[model samples]
Target chain A: MDHLSILENKSIFIIREAYYRFRNIAMLWSVGKDSTTLLWLVRKAFFGKVPFPVIHIDTTYKFPEMYAFRDEYAKKWGLNLIVGSNEGQVAAGMGPKKGSKLDCCNELKTNALKQIIEKNGFKALLLGIRRDEHGIRAKERVFSPRDDNFKWDYENQPAELWDQYKSTAEEDNHFRVHPILHMTELDIWKYIKRENIPITELYLSKEGKRYRSIGCLPCCSPVESAASSIDEIIHELETTHTSERAGRAQDKEDAYTMQKLRSLGYM
Target chain B: MQDQKTKCMVIGLDGVSQTLLSDYIEKGYLPGFKNILDSGFRLHQMDASIPDVSSTSWTSFMTGVNPGEHGIFGFMDLRPGTYKMFFPSSKDVKAPAIWEIIGQTSGGKGSTLHDKYREGIRRPLKSVVLNIPQTYPALPLNGVLTAGFVCPDLKNGTYPESAYNYLKSIGYLSDVDAQKAVEDRDAFFDELFLALDRRAEAFEHFMDNSEWDLFVSVITETDRLHHFFFDAARDEKNPVNKTFISFYKKMDEVIGRLYARFMEITGGQGLFITMSDHGFTVLEKEVYVNSWLREEGLLKINAVRDYYEGIEFGTKAFAMDPSRFYVNAEGRYPAGSVKGSDKKAVVADLKDRLLSLEYDGRHVIKAVYGNAEIYNGPAAASGPDLVCVANDGFDLKGTLKKEGVFGKGNFSGMHTRHDAHCILPASIEPGGRLHIEALAGFMLDKLLIQKPQRR
Candidate 1:
């Protein structure tokens, strides 16, 4: 098999294994290229149907285009979409302008996801985090576990050699199942082109600027690129030395902030 | 200005240390190295990878990355989540090698090296890589390659398929019979000399016949010789001392011949690099780290077994060959006992205990490094939690079947990380500490940056 097929098969196997093992499971969808590709993979895995609910922790700070795309894909893919938000934090006016990006992310994203997982009692939450995204994320396991407090103990992670994943978690803890952890940004684009996966139009070049990575509108910025199509994006990624997350504001705060953020359960 | 052909030649003498080479050169035994030294090549001491094994060190050298980036921590690694062991081959290397970096097309984009050459049109460089360790079952490249030690089959070891026939017809011996040294010393020397002759012959053939911008060949018989006959090589009164010297003299002649050919090919303008993967020293004691861990109650084996399957769930930490330590933490191992919260304390306690270890009133371990201190990359998480570096004269082994903490093995020499040697052309000046990993980048810069000057 080719490299993409191998990656797809591994991801599909992990998704299937998580489904079989977890009592209650859900997948996180961010309406970004990576997570959208993952959403496509989930449908392909279960034969044009998602077996579990797909959750999106909405900070309400995302681009309107992102919300539109998410809503459209949710109906088109026939997904049991669960939109989660920390209404109390939003009501309190917690945002990037109010405090540090770290605190903002924790309040809107981490806490919102915590509430969803707590309310749903999900034993596993499939994520589309790739190792090549960030340094701290690079250290993540295919089956990572979070504590009852939703803390990621990255320092002492479970050993995941070859295909063996840590399927079991302690009581009150949940596994952050990363199906596409091994795929790189380039691989995702290549797979998206090969599978003809539809992505948000915001990713394409608009006046020589395109979102290489999409998050809340206040935090993520667009890079200078002329990549209006999947092929152009692939070509751009092939030659670009800039990181996929280089345009994100939170990661630029400090070197250790991402590690600290991930440890506190911010994906 | 656009016509000068830039070429680079790297001669790897496995296990030849800086101190030993200097001493031999002073004694006029290795005239070939002396000639290079006379020809304005500066000898710099280089640091090998942690644990000082050939597989990790050579991989580090070739890929220009640490074990963390390359994902080859040692020769043998545990099949993660299990006690089963498997050898990490070239296929397991996570980073692009020097050759791969120079050989890649613009279409192959994901490899880390391609990012550097993105601005310009890349012309793939042809290389002749022969007998470099850890490169077994040769992968397809824009060059001819024959893998070095641990290469089980000749047909599988050679690339391009046609080179295999040429090698076979030339009676190329991949490696010498190390076992013969234990059975009969005289026959072992004969085998060693024959292997060296065959290797030199093959190197000469490639130097003359192959069209390569980068040529690399390693003489690995030196490492085998040092492992078995290091004492003889060092001592004048030993029985095989003369034979050992003769072997080096013969190797020196081959080096001279290769150097002359390199000069002819490049008109003395090309970059010529000579290096060893790691140095060697006479073994004072073979320290079994696992046995010490067992004695200290940190490790528990169910019974005497050949493999790590004998380890029980209660084991806090275990080791693989040559001082790679891993914590048997919960969720990592099938029945790991150490919890995530206690992993730091366990590793700390183990490090302290290892640092304080003494053998015959001498400290066995020189330094102990945490994973974060030495390694920084994607693959760091999969490496050893704590890598123990041994002091001189103490050879650290991770063998589980060993009966005691310290004993003498068949080997007279053990690998040392710091004394590895590199001889570089005087024109290039390295800024700081010379590491085995940096050589690949140096070679890449010299070869790729010297693109034909446009008039």
Candidate 2:
């Protein structure tokens, strides 16, 4: 078959395998291109039925546009949406301005996910991480195991040959299943165009600036571009050597910041 | 004369093993190989990638990286989070190929090479890559590319749109029909010869027409011949043995012609390398791994379906195609019963049992590798927990539909990991382990720049 079919088929297969294997599973939706595309694939895998809950770890620091996109799509897609937040931390006014970006991400994003996962006892979580987004993610596996403390052992990981993934983890531990780990920024855009997958307008240019990679409002920065449409974005990716995560503030804090964050269970 | 531009040519004979090629060369059945050997070519026994299939092996070859780095494990991979199977294409490959590296270094836009070219320090490098497997839906580069196997059609497979009509005009065939081979042997033989001739024609056409510094072409028909007629090729007494021998003889002639053209092009100064993705062996029995898992009470199935969707929840351990095993741990699967503390014991027990398995008074499994022992890299985490390499003649399969551990199928040959062949020039002495993954870097060192060490 062609390139896109191969990618779509493999992703669908992984989505199905995760559903069949995990009992208390949930997919993470950031209301971004990658995660939304992942949601679309999930629906397609189950024949327009999302068999499990979709958790959005709300840091209360997202753009208004992002919240609107999430609410609209969740209702339109008939999703069992669970909005998770570290209310204790948010009540204390913890944010990027109060501390280092790394610490803020840990308090707002990672702690929120940890609370949600613990409350729901989710054994596995489907994340929409791609290898090309960041160097640290390039070392990630399709089925990455996390310890009971929610720490990732980047070293001493399991061997994954063929399609046989490591689904076994220690007690109180869980798996972070990344179905889109093999995809690139270009692949996501091409797929979005091909499937006509709906995405937020923030990705398109407004006055010659667009958010190439979307996240919390304080962390994300827009790049100069004329890509108002999906086709133009695809073309931009083809000609540009700039990384997809170049606009993220946390990534620029240090070279090993991403690795450290991931090891600490940051998504 | 010694300062002429450096060039390289790679002739890939798919599934041509060093042992079998040596035997045939010793018997004077392949004069072209013998000529290459006499003319300063050193033959090395190379190892194929784990789960030694064309998709993984060839990707490893082109990318100069293991399956873990390249992100293509086999011909068929289970989609993440699902049991459904899908074929991985060129789009799934994570590592950049040697040609792409060459293209990037040869004065592509926004590259260091472009800076060098602006100062008139160097010229752009061109390449001609033909019929390399896993290159379907060929991407653009500095030169021409015609994808190998798994190419659905020529329209999408050939780059530069013009290459398509030219190839069509020359009647180039991407692959010989395997179904036709099964239905009629005579017509199949004719098709094989015709396909080889067309491949040679295309290779020669690009060699003369395209201004290229690197040229690569593979003869996949060798793999097809070995699969169906391995017994006949090995046995002189078989009625079709002569036909098999004749096919090799024709391949030898084609090789000789290509070598001559390469010599003329480079004036005998450029490098010409020959290799194969993996080796071939006679299939004595098809051993079903999942059947054994079921028989040992480690696996359970609800139905007799061909895929993993039939796998029952209570299953503790299961397998996928060609001897890949997974543990159904408590937190890993919905109905998994094996706890974290019991996982080590389960894996040990499974390995011991698999090694002890015997058929016809002979041991079936050669070795069993843990994930840590064989693979390394980011994608390695999703790899098979246990990979079993079977002894010669015992073709291990992971199909769940089999009723028993032992069975036979239509094919007569299976893939061998250790006996794959590579013929490099005597001047280039390779060090350390020899694998298909290292060949791309080796070629890169000869033709252009060195590939950076893997992190």
Pick the lDDT winner.
1
lDDT of 2 by residue, A212-245 (tens): 8889998899999999999999999899887765
Q: Give the TM-score of candidate 2.
A: 0.60
- Model 2 has an lDDT value of 0.81
Model 1, B1-455: lDDT tens digits are 22124688999999999988888999999999899999989898889999688888998888888888888887678787876666676788888777887777222323343355433325778889999998977888888999986676778889978889999998999887776777688888889999999999889998888778889999998988998878987799999899989998999999998998888877888889999999989888988888899999999986433367667768999998688899999988876999999999999999999999999899999999999999978888989999988998998887776788999867788889999999998877888878898788668766776532333
Candidate 2: Cα lDDT at B427: 82
TM-score of each: 0.62, 0.60
For candidate 1, lDDT tens digit of each residue in A141-222?
Answer: 9899988877787766878777778798889888999999999999999999999999899889999998888999988888
Q: Which residue runs does candidate 1 get wrong by more than 4 Å?
A: A1-267, B1-4, B105-114, B117-121, B304-306, B450-455
Residue B368's C-alpha lDDT in candidate 2? 92
Query: What is the lDDT of every predicted structure here?
Result: 0.84, 0.81
Clashes of each: 0, 18
Across residues B1-455, which tens digit of lDDT does each residue of candidate 2 receive? 22234788999999999888888899999899899899998888899988787878998898777766677766566666665555666777766677776676322222222222233214456789999998877888889999987666677789888888899999999887775566688898999999999998998899888878889999999988887778787898988789988988999899889998888878898889899999989889989888888998889876523356556677888886667788876765555668899989988988999999999999999989987888776677667778888888998877666789998866778889888999988887778557887787666665754333444
* Quality of candidate 1 docking, DockQ: 0.01
Best TM-score among the predictions, by candidate number: 1
TM-score of chain B of each: 0.96, 0.91
Q: Interface RMSD value for candidate 2, one decimal?
A: 20.3
